[model samples]
Every structure is written in structure tokens, then in C-alpha cells.
Target: MKQPGIFISFEGIDGAGKSSHIEALAAAFRGQGRVVTLTREPGGTPLAEKLRTLVLNDAMDPLTEALLVFAARRDHLQQVIEPALARGEVVVCDRFTDATFAYQGGGRGFDLAVLSNLELWVQAVPTLEGDFVRNPDLTLWFDLAPAVAAERLASARVPDRFESQPAEFFRRVADGYAQRAAHAPSRFARIDAALERDAVWQQISQVLVQRGWLGAAA
Candidate 1:
């Protein structure tokens, strides 16, 4: 049987404005009486948070970066996400495995095949029938042009390692997200991040309403 919880993940290159929308969506879910577990990847648990620090700041090769990311994800899943889902909560996570594919496999040019294996291994969820790979029931991909995203980030806070990368890197990352969405079109809803904030939010709300996750009146 499927788990009781609804898993929702927000994805995008930084400066795509996923943060505020994530909170807004969580609030929307709460308004509908769902218990929302708002969390993030690479840092949900104590061990994962420590790994997040290392991965974001320390200079590391593609292999090391991918390893640390998956390691943190494994811990986050075991400690936070899995439990929340099992308890029938709505887990609205800031990012998920798709970020790894977009950043490591695309931005850093890591091996996609290797990343695929890690995704399979780390995301497996056991059931009576067999183990199934866990993924978000819905993934909101805030699609934006790399240049536009960069412009938005210019006046933002200090950059992280990934955020400090060149425009070409973000281009590759955007392509990566496109590839992922194409591969799983049924699960992903692309939001045009270039739109005004209110328009973007309308798209988000429309998606949720269409999916029957929220009431039309909500």
C-alpha cells in the first residue's frame, strides 16, 4: 500500500524565488487542515546539516560532492522525511534529489549514471510487495533563464559555492532541470519564474488546485 502522506518538493536554480512560494504553499496546505512538515534537503537532521556545511563551502571534486549530497539525503530521509510521511503529514520540502542531478550531474559534469544508481539506492522505500523508489508526489519546478536568475541574485545575500559559479554553470543546471522534468512530466509542474510574484503564485495555486490537493475555494 502507498504511504499516507503527501510529499511535495520545490525545485529550481537559486534566485528562482522558490523560498517564499514554499512557505506560501505550506500555509495553503495548513489552511486546508493538513499538517505540513516544512523542511529542506542536505540539512534536515543534525548529521545532514553538518554535511550540508561541508558540501556547500568546502572545495570538493564532483565525486566528493555527489557523495556528500547523497549521504545527507539518506540521513534526511531516514530521520525526517520518511517519518513525517509515515505519520500522514504533508511534507513540503525545499529541495530533493532533482537538485543533485541538476547541480552535480549537470553543473559539475558528474556521471549521470552514477548519480542514477545513488538515487535508486538512497530513495528506495520498502513495502510488502517490494521496495519502491521514493519521489515527491508533486515537484514544483520554478523555471527561469540563467541570466534572469543571476540578475535576481546579484543583490541577494552572500553566495554559496554553487551560487558563486559562472553563468555557464547555471545554464547547464537549467538544462538539467529541463531534462528531469521531461523525464517525469507527470510529476513536475513547471512555473515560469520570470513572471511577476503574484502571477507566479497564481500558477502555483492553480497547480495545487488542479491536482485536487487544495480546494478551489481555498
Candidate 2:
């Protein structure tokens, strides 16, 4: 496949406020006359959404959770992401494999090598360019203190399994994301999630402009 579309992902801890801006960004793209596919990990396609519920609500082993997330990811890629990209639409996804590494590998102490293997197996796609692993062209990582995030999450909604984890777990997850960002500095734009919503959006808009994805007027 020759992909002409752009793939972007928003990532952060549960209360980092990344989820709140995804649709707004997608709307900006839409306003530019771009076709945007706004989707989420572990829950894009029908089957994946079912897996999402199980993964979020059920009590399971660390390895079991990782496996389930990757399974949903595979289905999501095949059923939603790939098709949207093939059609030259912008695909904006909320969370992805990064969350698996954060939650499972870092927080739960699963093997990083195992997570890497799953990423390759589940995301590698055959393209005219060769065997290409599906990865976001741009990843916006919302960075916030775990305590602040916990406070935000407290009033947002009922806590799910992951959300209910202790602050220490979230600290580890944040470290995991930091490691990933350090390893792939060019692909990630770390945003301060503690900022006001408008300020955060301005940061995002600046990135879009710098990337040539949006005009200055936008």
C-alpha cells in the first residue's frame, strides 16, 4: 500500500487531558477540508471495542492484559486504521501501543522485549515501501504530574481498573512514556497538560503549523 494519509496519536495518563483535545484537533483538520478519522485504541472497530470493555473492567494478569490490548490493536489496524489511511484520510487516534508499554511494561513490570515483539507483529504492514511498521507520524504526549492527574481523574468519572491504580504506578507509566519519547524524540511533541485548555490548544496548533499540516491562518 502507498499511504498518502497522515497518522497522528494522542497519548498520556488517564487524566492528562489528551482525550479532551483530540476531537478539537480533528475538527480543525476537517475545517481545512481534510477528511479526518477520529478513533481510539483498544476500541476502534466493533470487536476491538468489546475487547476494550473487557480490558478496562475485568481483573486480569499483567500479561493477559497486554495480550488483549495487542489483540484489539491488530483488529483495529485491520478494520479501521489501515482502511482510513489507504483512502488518504487523516487518522487521529487516542492512545495506542504506547499505553501498553506504559501500563503493562512499566507499571506492571511486563517484559519490554515482549511488548516490542507484539508491536512489530501486530502493526507491521506490507507496503510498496517494503515491510513497514505502522506508527504515528506525529504523537502528541500530554505531560502532567501524577498527583495533578489523579486529582483531575477523581472528579471526571468513576475509576476503571487502570485509573484506580496507585500514584506510584502512574509515576512509572509516566517514566515509560518519557523513555519512549527520549528514544524517538523526532516523533513526539510533549505538551504540558497542566496548562489552561486554550494554552494547550495553542501549543498543539503551533505544532500543526510547524509541520505544515495547517496554514498560519488556521
Against the true structure, what is every candidate's RMSD?
A: 1.6, 1.7
> Which one is best on lDDT?
1
Give lDDT tens digits, candidate 1, residues 91-177. 999999999999998998999999999999999999999999999999999999999999999999999998999999999999999
TM-score for each of the candidates: 0.97, 0.97
Off by over 4 Å in 1: 1-3
List per-prediction Cα lDDT, in the order shown: 0.93, 0.92
- Residue pairs with backbone atoms closer than 3 Å in model 1 (clashes): none
Per-residue lDDT of 79-134 in model 2, one digit per residue for the tens? 98999988999999999888888889888989999999999999999978788789
Clash counts per candidate, in order, are: 0, 0
> What lDDT score is found at residue 72 in candidate 1?
94
The TM-score between candidate 2 and the true structure equals 0.97
